[model samples]
Target: MKKLFQTSSLVSVLNVSDYTVALTWYSAWLSKPDETPMDGMAEWRIADNAWLQLDATAETVKPSAAIIGVNDLAACRTVLLEAGIAVGEIQDWEVVLSCDLHDLDGNKISLAQIISQQ
Candidate 1:
């Protein structure tokens, strides 16, 4: 099949109801956003080619999910737990170790650490 659009960058957006609360919670979970392009929106540079964005809206939103690639899932989970966040049990999938959590708006966020089989 022929390509429809030229590639540039990828963005994953999690729409939320409360901007202020979501901003604070996400800051604790992912650190301060690298950029706040405009009001009611925040962005994090997940990788050279990808980004994660938080958008504030009053309309109904379906829960969205995102997986973050971390180098140490255990340490990441520990930090979040200490911050009083309800993080889920870590799952070991042979090639990956991961844990899950929800944002202020119930958006599912997963932290995954890839294990080298070498």
Candidate 2:
């Protein structure tokens, strides 16, 4: 069998009850305004090909979770703190450093920084 499709990008969605509030919070949290790809939807470009989408919904949307890799965990933590977002203490796992945080809708976002091989 041959590969039918190549994995080129990823788009993760986090549903929220309040679109305007979520948009403001996410814009501050990410330090960038979201792009409106359509009505009632906002998207943040996480990387070159990765995106995080926020959808406004009337129903109770389940909280979403994602693990994001960063180049500097400490720096990221500081930024989050300065932004008034609470983040867990950084834990060393021998191979990487990680911390956890949640959004307004209680969606979990884990951040990890890989240790470079010496």
Per-residue accuracy of model 2 over 1-118 as CA lDDT, tens digit each = 9889899999888898788888878887785545887777888888899888888854778889988889999999999999888999999999999999887888888999999879
Best candidate, TM-score-wise?
Answer: 2
Best lDDT goes to which candidate? 1
Error of 1 at 41 (Å): 0.8
Candidate 1 residue-wise lDDT, 1-118, digit = tens: 9899899988999999988999998888679999999899999999998899999954877779988899988998889899988899999999999899898678998889999989
The lDDT for every candidate, in the order shown, is 0.89, 0.86
TM-scores for every predicted model: 0.86, 0.86
RMSD of each: 2.1, 2.1
User: How displaced is residue 102 in candidate 2, in Å?
Assistant: 0.6
